[model samples]
Structures are given as structure tokens and as C-alpha cells.
Target: MENPIFKDMLVLELASVLAGPSVGQFFAELGANVLKIENAATNGDVTRNWKLTTEPADTDIPAYFCAANWGKKSLALNFKEKEELQQLYKLVQQADVVIASYKPGDAEKLAVDYETLRSINPRLIYGHITGYGAADDRAGYDAVVQAESGFMYLNGEPGGGPVKMPVALMDILTAHQLKEGLLVALLRRERTGEGQLVEVSLLQAAVSALANQATNYLVAGQEPKRMGSDHPNIVPYGSVYTCKCGKQLVLAIGDDRQFRKLCTILGAEGMAAIPAYATNYSRVQHRQEVNERLSQLIGQQDREGLLQQLQAQHVPAGAIYTIPEVFAQPQAQEMLLRNGDAKPGVRQIAFKVQHQEQAQLTPPPSYNNYKEDKID
Candidate 1:
């Protein structure tokens, strides 16, 4: 089999939860040797105990902990111990990348700060994930960052209070940011033979992810309101219609032509002729009327049959699926990867980079899975 993209590269993962570990996991998938450093004194990463249900199991490690840590080796160390700190410093000197998500000065206190490590290894690419920027000392959590970054403010239904997203969106986005920065830094290192510090924060990621919402506020002075799933600039774009059987069908009518086609499919082609519904801009101005009319008509039909018809007509529509339904999909099933007969397994890495051989992945490691005696 051919070697992976990062065959000889070594990554030292000093981060926990999602953002930092996720970057390590990504490198592991791409064939980098990722060694995750867990604090043995604290029973390792906190996610190991984030159990979803109260039921007892063979290992206390929860699915949350396994999700982003698959395919990496684990080394437990207590930085407070001089020997362990010295060993970690040795590993840092040999590593190509080091990723950590410590609060402001905590890295310095732990003696793993970028400045110290860079002095030890001039070619080490150091990545730091923060809750805010490098200057902010506040601890960053995904939910709190969601609220502070204006994402929560524009999330819930109209006239409703701000709602935090159910997922750790900020952490996930921050991971991608770190991954991109690290890749670019690695490339530059190849040319200059020197590594640089890369930094990403949940606050910065959340703001950058605003996309058009941020542009609307800056360019048009339009403060976004909570519209639930609705798009701010498009009409008939965010409304969910309940069918006769109680399933929700979401329609994404992107342009006038699609809207006209949807009107025709609902046997309300005349609605397209009305001045208020003729164009997307006018429809946005009269979104309530448009949604109410569409919802009433859509509610009269069965969901599956209507979805089939919509698909046949080339309309952009889909059923709003529950979590189970999402995983049950053929596309989703194809992406699932398993090791042995484990009850649950990690999904395939999202990248579509084709390779001659499939990358093999092992289950997440148990605490202190590797011993100090095994170190070179």
C-alpha cells in the first residue's frame, strides 16, 4: 500500500474536549503519528466521563470522548512531575506539530507554551486554541461562545429568546480553522525550514462563520433577528411544512424559477402571478403570507408521496430527519467505520481525498494506554 500524506510526521496533542483533539484526529487519519497527552493525575480527559445514559459499561469512557480521539495513541503524564515534564519536552523536540487548548496563561504555567517549545525545537509547528483571542483569559466553552458571538442571538424563532445550538458548533468550527492554519504552516515550514505559531479561538471562528449574516450587518446596517431556520435574505427558504402524517418537509426555494415551480407543484400556479409573490424580494416582504399559504397546501398532502413528487419535479426539498433517521440514511451508513464488533464506531473522515488504500483506524485508547517504558 502507498504511504499516507503525513507518513513520518508526528503530532503532540495536548488539548482536550473537541477542538484540539479533533485537529489531532484529522492528522491521525492523514497518516500522522499523533500522541495524545492526557493528565494521569486527573484521570485524563474530562470527556471520558461525559456519559449519555446512566447505564454502566465496561469502560467509563463515553462516546463523546471516542468521537474525536479515534486512531491516536495515548500517553498519560502529569506535568507537575518534573520527570513527566522532561519527557514531554523530549517528545516536543521530536514532534512536527503541537496542539493545545489551554486558557490564556495556563500553557505557560504548565511549561508547554509555544514560546518555550519553539525555543526547544525551531521547526515545531505550534497550534493554540483559545476561548477568545490569545490576550483573553476567559475560559471559552462552546455554548457560552455561541451566545457571545451573536450566533445564539440569530438562532431561535422570531420574537423568541436566544437559543444555544444543541451541538458544540464553535468547537467544531474552531477545529477546522486550526487544521487549515496548521496545514499552511507545515507547507511554509517545508520552504523556510522553520515553524510558526498558529492560533484560533472560538469567538473568532464563530464571528467568521457568520458569512452573509455578518456582511448584512456591516454593509446594510441590518441587525439580524432570530428567524429560526429561515434565511434572512430569502423568502420561502426557511419554512417547514407539516404533512398530513405529521412529518416535516423543508423547502429551499432559491430563486424565482424554483418558487414558480413549487407554486405549480402545489396547484397554486396563480400564486406566482400575484405581485407580492412574483419575485424573491417581494416574497421576502410577504414571507408570512407565502409561508401560511404554502403550509396550508402542503399540510393537505402525505409527506412521503409529496417528497417523491417534489423530487420528481426537481425541487429542492427534504424531510427534516431525527438523529436516528439521519444515521439510517444510505449515504450516512456508507460513511460509518467500525473496528471489530464494537457497539459504536467512528464515522469516516469527511474528506473525499481518494487514496490507493483505505486508512486503517483503531478505537480510542484507554487511559494511559501506552506506558512510559514504551517511549523511545
Candidate 2:
């Protein structure tokens, strides 16, 4: 699991919370030396205090903080202090990258601006994340961005109120965008022996993720509506049906062939012959009727057996699984990352390289103190 692809790389992280730290962890997983710089004035990253009710009150390093803070060295410094500022300058000399999440004018005020750091190290790649954009200094939270980006409006049930996703999806998406930008920047530097600034904003990332949903609005003027576990374009694709065992199954019938096969499997070939449900377009137009018929047919059989039969017939169908059920599977268990006695975490890197069986994840950094012993 030891892929030292970035073993010689040095990342100086001045970012806090998820997006910036998540990028740091990505490099750390690649065997880079990541130095996480937190502000002493604020008692370090606020996420350190974002503990669940079940967590111990006396602890500063909560589960939320550890989520994206592993495999890095931490430093809490008052940047205004001359000595503390000098420490950062020294790291800049040897750092390959600097990750920051400062507001519009705050970076300049704190002297950690990209212009200032790039002046010290011209070849240093600066990755910056913002809530809105450079023009706006409004603080960005994932929940707020989710609402503003049209995600919340399209989520949840058909008639239900807007609902923010359970996870910090915007931050995660922004981190991924920043990572792709940084990687491309690194590739550009390799070719030209130069470095540049890479920027990502939460609002932009969430909007970018709208993908086809945005296109449907722009191209066809079809305003997206909330349809729980349902797709706008494809019928039977995300439609959930309950079985006799009370278990749920969902179908992803992508083509006419699959739809016909689904009908054959459910002993309802007659339904597919009915001119209205003949094609995907017709099925979409008659969504209610199709769903009701499928519900009745599926309800006559057990979920597990029906799912197996559908798969055997090349029909895309699966059973709904709870979070516990998800991790209980072998493939999910294999994605778990464990370092010492820390609670199990899942790896962010999903794709595998040739001959790469696992990832080498280290322990999360100490909340604020610098661990000189951890330095190689």
C-alpha cells in the first residue's frame, strides 16, 4: 500500500475545515510531508470542536476533525507574531504546495496571500478554496452553499420542503475540484518548470455538480422538481418497489431491451406490449402507471429472489441497503482505513493503481502541537 509517488513532496497547509484539509490528506496518502498550519488566535480549526453528542466533552480531537485531518503534521501559530511568521516563511522555501482557505481580504491582512507566498517561492503551487468567490468575502458553509446551488431544492420528496444532504457534499465536491486543479497545475509545472495559483469555490463546485440537471434546465427549460429516489429522464431508473418480504428493490432499466426483460422477469410481458409503456419515452410519460404496475408485480415476490433473478436476466436491479448493511459487505469493509486505535475511516482514494491492493494511511495529526519526531 506504500505508494511513495509523492514521498519527496512537501505540502504546507494553511487551510482549516474540510475542503483544504481533505486536499492535504490526499497528498499525505501519496506519502507527502504535509504541514498543517492552524491559527492560534482561533484555538485551531473549528472542526476540532465539532464533536457529536456521544463523544467525550474533554477531547479536542473529535471524530469530525479526524475525518480529513489524518497523515499530516500540525502547527498552531499566531501569524501576526514576527517569529511565527518567520517559521511559515521557512516552510515556504522547501514546500511544493501551500493550501489556503482564507476569505477575500483576510489572506492579505494575515500576509499569507498567494502573491506574498509566491514571491517567496515562485515554484510553489497555491491552492485556495472560498465559500462564494474572490469578489465576495461571505463565509461559505456547506449547508448554505447546498441551498444556494439548487441542490437542496431538488432533493427529498416530491412535495416535501428543501433538505440539505446529511454529509458536507459541497465541501467534498469542492475538495475534489481543487485536487483536480492542483494535479493539473502540478503537471503544467512539470512541463514548464513553473507554478501557479489554483482556485475552487463551494458555490461553483456545487453548481458544476448539477451536471445533467443543469443542462435539462438550460436546454429544455424543464425546471427540476424533487422526486424521491427517482430520475427525471429515465423511467424505472431509481423507482423503488417493495416486495412481499417488506424489502425494497430499485430498477435501472436503461433501454427498451432491459424494460422488456424486466417485464418478462416479472411475468408481465403484456404490460410491455401495451403501446403506452413500449419505449423509454412512453414509460416516462406514463410514469405513474408504470410504477404502480411494477409495484404490484414486485410485491408478489420476495426482494432477494427477485433481485437475483433480475441480475441473472441482465436487468439492472438492486436491493435497498442501510448504512450498516453497506459496510457489512466485504467490498465496503476492505475500504476501511485503520491507524492505531482510532475509529475506522474510509479511504478517499477509490481508484486503484496496478498492483495496488490498499492505501497506507497514517494516524491523524495532534490537534495543535508540532510533532518534530514525526518529521523524517
Candidate 3:
């Protein structure tokens, strides 16, 4: 029977860890049969033990592995044996795509580079997810990429030392770009009946994902500073006012009209009437003064009261929430943030698949679960 999404395609994933595994994850969700090939000596992906929230009652389940390896089949292979390498080459010949994340020349050393794979299957889409491009020797960890891309410097408070983002934001961002690159190659292959190499670098992806911060620094000579919560160009566009309940809300007024509406909500009519606060530019110039006064005014109200009032005026505002509080939110629940349990033997965790209808949950397989079956 022809598949609804990817009918004839098979994905051979030699990628481990987050960004590389994420590429296979996307294909697995969209009806592609994905075989995740892992090394047997190290016993598979390195991310399996990075972070574990719950102690596994059985063999330890790596929660980090669970986040990136869902929706795919795992197979263990020891390529040091020539027979195993032969088996891998046969699988590559049958696959529509092959994705790997080895260093620049490592894949060639393994005899699994694009040239060798394309010879096996000329129609194979080979994706190389690397830390830097094929030319760079520097290592490419998420924090390393963040610092190299100038992301770490532009975040946090002004004049403070560079702060590393807690999560692997650069890795996740590269995963998104990897997915895009794979999909685009798939589409192109569909039209042309030919496959090509798709390459994504951690440093390049991080730089691309930095958005306007990178552009502003490149085009204009000004380095983007860490302004805490406030926007560089827009006043009243950040965290403001600790409420009586001690909850902080971000009040982002993009223009003067919104500022006036915020003023009316806070009953600061006199402050809105001031000439220096009339325009967004003037307010931005006097942002410290504006933030101080707004903080004082909103401090008188409770969080619930301030949120309700601001929302009623169609202002863009949101209260700072802990992870649990965010999970409890109706909007987050609707968006599938509370994914519950993915499959048997997998503990419940939040997956970032936003669309409920499109979301498919499956537990990450154990590293040793994939064993070779002799073909009849």
C-alpha cells in the first residue's frame, strides 16, 4: 500500500544526540521508516545519560536521549567488523536519505561519506550536520556556538558578564534548520527524481537564528547590549512592575497608542499627559524614568488584577511563570506542552510538538534493542 506521506522513502540515520537525531525524528513522524544506526561499543547515543529526572527501575533510561530519539527504530552495529560495514552499505543503498554528524573528515575515515553513499544509491539525500562547516577545526558545543555567534553576549543584563542560556538553545535552533533543510531536499528530490547533499553547521545555524541582533551588529556598528527585559528601540517593552502579589508581568507596548492605553489601565493619566512621554522615541530616550514610574504605579495592584485589566484593553502582556505554572496554563495545554506519556516504558515529559493532531508520541528505544536479523 502506498503511504500517505512518504510512500517509498526510507531514512538511514547515523546521527546521534539532539540535532542529528531530530532530523530523523521529523521523518519518522511524517510516515518515513527511519533506521537509527548506533555504535555498539559506547552502546549507542551519548545523550542517553546526560540528564535523568527519574531513576530508571530497570537499566537506566537517558531522559536526554528520550527527548530526541522518539518515533524512530534503533539498531546497534559494530562497524569495526568488515561484515557490519558491508551491512551498513547495503542499508544505505536502500535508503532515500542518510544523515550523519561526524566531524569534517571523520565520515570519510569511516568510509560513510556522501561520495561513498551516493555511489551506493545515487538518489540518496545525504545530510551532514556539523559544528562548524567542513573547513573548521574548532569544536561545536551549544555553548561554544552561542558564544561564537555572539548570542551569549547580547543576552542577560547590560554590563554583566556573558551568560550561557540554561538550555541548548543553539542545538534546538539547529535542529529546526536541519529539519527545514531535509524537507527542502525531499521536495527537490520529488520534483527532480534526484537526491543531493544537505549541510547545516551549528555555528551557521546559531548565527542565522540570532535574528535582528546579528543583523543590527553587522549592518550598523552598534553592538546589541543586554538590556535585561527592555527592548533596545521600544520603551515600556519589557518586564515591569512587581505586583502586590510579587508576580512580574511583561508589558510590551509597541507604539505610543499602546503606551497611552497602558497608562489609562494603571490610572497614570498625568504621566501619559507629559510631553516627553508622548512619542515612542521620547519615551525610549527616557526609558529608565518611565520604567521607574510605571513600576511604582503598578506596584499598587495585584497580579491578577493588573493582567485582567491590561488584557481587557488588548495590550500584549504576560505574567512570568515557573515551568509548572506554564504547564498548568490552558493555552499551553492546548498547544500540547503537556504531552503526558509518549509510549510504553517512557515517563511523561513535555515534548515541543505544538500541533496536537500532528503529534505522535513514542518512547526512545534502548541502545541495545536494535539487533541484526539475518534476511531469509
How does each model score on lDDT? 0.87, 0.89, 0.77
Over all chains combined, what TM-score does candidate 1 have? 0.96
Q: What's the candidate order when arranged by decreasing lDDT?
A: 2, 1, 3
Q: Model 2 TM-score?
A: 0.96
lDDT of 3 by residue, 1-376 (tens): 2333653468888988778887777676665677889987787787766765465644434656766676567887777778889989988877888989888888888888999889888889999988999998555788888888887887788778888887888878888887788879889988999989999899999878877776677887667888877887788887656988888888888888888888888888778879889898899889888988988988898999889988998988889888879868875665342234643222122343343333353567766665555211
Q: Where does candidate 2 stray beyond 4 Å? A: 1-3, 355-359
Q: Please list all clashing residue pairs in model 3, or write none if there are none.
A: none
Return the lDDT, model 1, position 65. Answer: 87
- Candidate 1: residue 263 Cα off by (Å): 1.1
| CA deviation > 4 Å runs, candidate 1 | 372-376
TM-score of each: 0.96, 0.96, 0.89
What are the candidates' C-alpha RMSDs? 1.7, 1.7, 3.6
User: Which numbered prediction scores highest in lDDT against the true structure?
Assistant: 2
Model 3 per-residue lDDT at 361? 39
lDDT of 2: 0.89
